[model samples]
Target: MTDEPRLSAQDMIERLGPVLSRRTRIRAVTALLAGVAGAVFVGTLWWSEPGPLPGRTHLAFALFTMFCLTWAGYGGWLVTRRVALFATDRVIAAWIGLAASLATTAVIIVVAVQRGTSVGLALVVGGLFVAVALVLAVRAHARRAALLRRMHELSGREER
Candidate 1:
């Protein structure tokens, strides 16, 4: 056996606990709050409409509301399970979030253009969403790189 001492299971757990818990809590709360707020806003609009709406509009609202609820459910699961999300998992999740943001932005822009109303506002909001998503993606990638570098350093030390 190598002379280097290893961390005990408890020590490893203690080391990881703070890092994982903070990330998990932040992600869970963000997801839950965004999802619930989106759902409520969309639902309110759909319910309080002044006149009859097209079937497609109804369908769109339902789908968007469902999408928000899905995120909320995911957040709830994360909170309840407190699963350990690794750096790679975070990278993947960030990419998924970026894609979702892009698609949603595209849809919003299309709808605004078709309606000929608030097109500029839609574009502005969409840009913000895409920007946030891009930032998250970049941060995730940087984090993963850092973790990989740390892993390599530890392995190199162990080999010596």
Candidate 2:
């Protein structure tokens, strides 16, 4: 007889509640921090010039926050699922995050262009987000690789 205990769907969900809540709280706090930092950065840049274009910058920051939150939520979901996140999942998540960032960047760029703001600024913001995404994705990939390697080594030793 197996020692594993059977659990129903509701039981599983109930058991996962605390874990999910913890994940959600962490994500929310991190998102809040990012939002504040983004707002400050964009606000400083947008208001640096003597004009009425701060509104466009605010809009850009809003979109950027939305994208970041969405990406973070995806990442948090992956973590909460307890899946053996492989390098492939990391790469895929990075791609999805990049896609979300690019989409938001495009929208902001369009807004900035319509408001007669400098396009270079929007490009800079987009590039910054891409860079961050790349770093995170690479780190996640490395972690996954290390974990797999350790598992392989342990399993091989058990056969001796």
Candidate 3:
């Protein structure tokens, strides 16, 4: 008797469904999200009030938020089209890291400006954010490299 185990129909469907879904519609979904984020960013810029301490902070936060949303959406769109499921984990991790860094930096800058924080203190805070971001980005890059190596090994085996 053959040693290969047979997969049931449900098992096959479960295995293949995600591959098919990723190949078919991931790019479209990312694009739609990008468009929506861009629209919201614009809307916030056009409509948010601008006349107080909190308003100033809000505006600064909004700018950073816009950058985060646009970058994530656009990057997701690009990565999905090219990498499919290969490097998505790396990309998402990097995006989260960057968003955290930028948001932290922006908030610090806003608060510093609003409350007249000393330059030394602001610099220290900024440094902390940078350190955290660097760590996260490096981890993500390592993870991606590992994944790429695995894919390369699998492909080489298939050729043999």
Candidate 4:
């Protein structure tokens, strides 16, 4: 083995630069803004209704509000956390995001159809979400593969 010393945690972190990248920061901000805006809009609408709504309507409003709040909380947690995400973590996160996007799209389309609303608009929005998620997933997988390749190359060199 070579006599080169191993990198310390601080050195490794310095070499990696900022763990919370610009893209991640932007994503967290977007999620927070969207979630808070959605929650506020739904809450206001529910509160300002003229007449007494059905139990099912109230339940729906509550569920939607909670969902928005949950997303906001997740965003807030991500923003506050200082942990660095590894390649495997990124891959898992990307998959989770893809699943969530697909589920959300399905729900939107189903709701639009059930309500006799403009299914076209719903489909367009859902398509956009799915496309974005797919792109992110692909990028994540590529990044992981590149990292793994680099790791193997470095290890091979160390052995020699």
Candidate 5:
């Protein structure tokens, strides 16, 4: 009998045997979702409400809803992809949440710069959005890293 462990989908890819197994399909889906979320967020700025004061105090939140949806779509993609790979949904949700928050912030900045009546005030408004986005992104990244580590441990155990 052979002493080698049974070859898995990942192993098949290494041998160049039609690399796109179910697992690869999942990862690719996650990556594609992330890319799509980012693109939608950057592209959606044209619809934000212009403001005289350039602050959230007056801006409507319909655009914000879109941002959240984009994020959710990405997360769903990630989870589905991960499920296909190793049956784990770790870090996928976090990635989507982070991308959504940042995209919303970007939209706010665009609105402030292009639609705000005052240039100086618009910069201040945009700056605040950037700061918030930075904090959210950092938090999301940290959380995702932790979850990914846990997933790795679980996956290792499964292999054994």
Candidate 6:
């Protein structure tokens, strides 16, 4: 007979809840910090520029904070499930990077067109975000290859 004790589904879930919650505390705190930092960064930038355009920046920051919180929640869920995170995380990171790049780029373009300004710091920052997104794409591709190799090994299949 196996030495393990049998547990009902409900019992298993109930027991796991506290354990998962403990495991997720660090992730939750990190996400919260990131969200606050992002908001503060945006707010500071807006404060420096005394103009009506700051409203748009505030809106953008709000969107960013919402995205960060949602991403954090997803990460916590992943931890709670005790899933291997590397493969899944890369795709999510790439998606987030792409979204940030696109959103920032759009904001820069719209602001430039509307305000007839050039060489602003936001434009430079947006360019940097694009570069970061490119890096994320490359990293995600590498992680995917690694994941496939691991799966092949686990399945006792020879890799081509």
RMSD of each: 4.3, 8.6, 7.5, 4.4, 10.1, 7.2
Off by over 4 Å in 3: 1-46, 50-62, 71-83, 92-96, 99-116
Q: How accurate is candidate 6 locally (lDDT)?
A: 0.65
Steric overlap count per candidate: 0, 0, 0, 0, 0, 0
Q: Looking at model 6, how many pairs of residues clash?
A: 0
Off by over 4 Å in 5: 1-117, 157-160
Computed on alpha carbons, the lDDT of every model, listed in order, comes to 0.74, 0.64, 0.63, 0.74, 0.54, 0.65
Error of 6 at 9 (Å): 25
lDDT of 6 by residue, 68-125 (tens): 6655665555455554343565566577768868786887778777797774677778
lDDT of 3 by residue, 75-120 (tens): 5565455323555554665666577577667677767776877657
Judged by TM-score, which candidate is best? 1
User: Once model 3 is optimally superposed onto the true structure by TM-score, how far is the C-alpha of residue 149 displaced, in angstroms?
Assistant: 0.8
Better candidate by TM-score, 4 or 5: 4
Between candidates 2 and 3, which one is better according to TM-score?
3
Better of 4 and 5 by lDDT: 4
User: Which portions of model 6 show Cα errors greater than 4 Å?
Assistant: 1-29, 36-58, 119-124, 157-160
Q: What TM-score goes with each of the models?
A: 0.64, 0.48, 0.52, 0.59, 0.35, 0.58
> What is candidate 2's lDDT per residue for 1-160, written digit by digit as tens?
8998665434444465453456545654565566456656655665575756556566765666556565556555555554333355556666767777777778768887898989898999988997887787788778788867866665566556
Clash pairs for candidate 4? none
- Stretches of candidate 2 off by over 4 Å are 1-96
The sequence of per-residue lDDT tens digits that candidate 1 reaches over residues 75-99 is 7766675433446556755776777
Question: Which consecutive 10 residues in model 3 have the weakest lDDT in total?
Answer: 8-17
